[model samples]
Target chain A: MATGRIVIDVERCKGCELCLEACPQDVISLADTFNAKGYRPALLADPNHACTGCALCAVVCPDACITVFRDVPTPKAQVALEV
Target chain B: MATLTADITEKLVYQRPDALADLYTHYCPGCTHGTAHRLVAEVLSELGMQEDAVLVASVGCSVFSYKYFDVDAAEAAHGRACAMATGVKRVNPDKIVFTYQGDGDLASIGLAETMHAAIRGENITVIFLNNAIYGMTGGQMAPTTLPGQHTTSSPFGRDIKLTGNPIHIAEILGSIPGTAYSVRRSMHDARHVIQAKKAIQTAFEAQQKGLGFSVVELLSSCPTNWKMTPNEALSWVRDNMVPTYPLGDYKVHEELQSKRGRGR
Candidate 1:
């Protein structure tokens, strides 16, 4: 399984909630607190690691405040073959 | 059984457009200006016009258009963006020139400027944002405001007789023989946002080809001025404004007809 991370430019986010709705994994939501601009920034809650890293939230973000990154499992060590 | 160990590497899937600065814009929450800025920046980046664009920023909430775009931009007087862009495009023939205007600036005060620019076939792109109100000036009724639409100036709903009818800018420009491309799109949803970007691409391509005046009228939402929640404002655009302004291609140069569908 793949893991994903969301990076939010808290200052740039306008709390439009478009990204909250666009997140297929429902890991995004509006934070209870406000940013320096007196606007609520979007927060991610992937306690169960349900994020699939689809990037739909970033695609629909008007402010371009969100960036999505995903990790792919690297190859494992190979075993030597016996003759 | 031996456990297999592996490493994980993070890869970037999506990031902000480079044509836009890292600074936060001053637009109100839920306003489409942010989306509009993103789309224009994305188009310029895609067309490789980051260093070769001249943006004629107009008055209104978007008066600071120069701040959002990383390219060379100049602020134009109220309703004079088209005129300024004409001069800029003429002097810098190799650069991609464009004007980001609102309804109040383009349709009402700058009507003559916008009309004459299209009539003269100026080789420049015009990204017109029609929110049907003077968003920066406290929500006054704009020239494109629909009949019976309530605005600060029309508290009791717009009177069709006194206020006159809403102007169809895309249709008007599209009908003009000099206008090479014209279309209307929305930013209310993700799918339409993608479509809006395609429209921007086609418009820029027309300017790059020197096909003459091209316009993309964007049906934008003003959540703050409209006095509606952000999401409700989007629904209003899809349900209310779309009917008044509609959306589609009003004109396309014969040569660029095939390229229009390339974005799809």
Candidate 2:
């Protein structure tokens, strides 16, 4: 199973709402909580399950705000006998 | 017999630009509008703003600019492209905003919008194409139309007593305090075309940096209106229009280094 992560850089964000529209899975939203500049920054909800790592959000972001990372699980290693 | 491979130059001519849509343009052959579209499209691709950029096209031969550019676009009312672009930029500040207009549209009907946008220092790129005549509306006199130049409206040759002299839009816009960068260029020949691309890239870079208003005035040729072949039309622009609309950087902000400098 793969998990998705959404990271945002609040400082560079201009509150353009482009990522909000670009999110096809509707996992991204803008919270009422304001950043240091008093502008509403984008917030991600249910990121682990809802986001498919489509990367549309990253592509449409004019200020290049959001970055999506897909976590792929690694295979387990076999134990060696010490006889 | 020796095996021969296709030369890179031959491949270059066969490869079509991906940024431009596969549609037959309505512009006349040898019209500079096609070159202008290609330049803008290439810039959008180079900056990776193709998807995020929204172009506002004004009424003119460039009104169909939306058809050629692969990016998102909206057709504005005649001469209202600047006003529409202002709204789009404000609403979606992140997306690259641009307005393409002709001399008549920018210097005449949309004069107020153009002046205000420059004065307010809107962070948008305006591509002003000055062919000196109203191309789509027939060979009519335009604000940038040279003095003593005959058109359909000025069949007896433009008279200073009747029709006023050409307006230097780039120079006038450069005088405004809010304008960050402005350049007047031409596409009469290969050399001028290269210079024009540089001017256009600068204008787009200014917008990307969120700098104030940027305008690139291109003194284009109108062969149909001039009643000459493509070559003659280009020669006429070089000889006549260059004297009236000299090519150079009218204004640039020495203090601003780049986009990072502006943001800081």
List clash counts for every candidate, in order: 0, 0
Candidate 1 second chain TM: 0.95
lDDT of 1 by residue, B119-192 (tens): 99999999999998999999999998888989999999989999799999999999999999999998888778
**What's the residue-level lDDT of B171 in candidate 2?**
93
Q: The CA-based lDDT of model 2 is what?
A: 0.76
Candidate RMSDs in Å, in order, are: 3.3, 18.5
Clashing pairs in 1: none
lDDT of 2 at B249: 75
Q: Score the docking of each candidate (DockQ).
A: 0.51, 0.01
True-structure Cα RMSD, model 2:
18.5
**Whose lDDT is greatest here?**
1
Error of 1 at B230 (Å): 0.8
Estimate, for each residue in B1-264, the C-alpha lDDT of model 2 and write its tens digit: 011111111111112346678665667646778768777776788778888989999998888888888888999998889889999999999999999999888998999999999999998899999999999989899988888898999998889877667899989999998898888988776556657767777888888888789999988888889898666787898899998887877788664434211100
* Interface RMSD of candidate number 1: 3.5
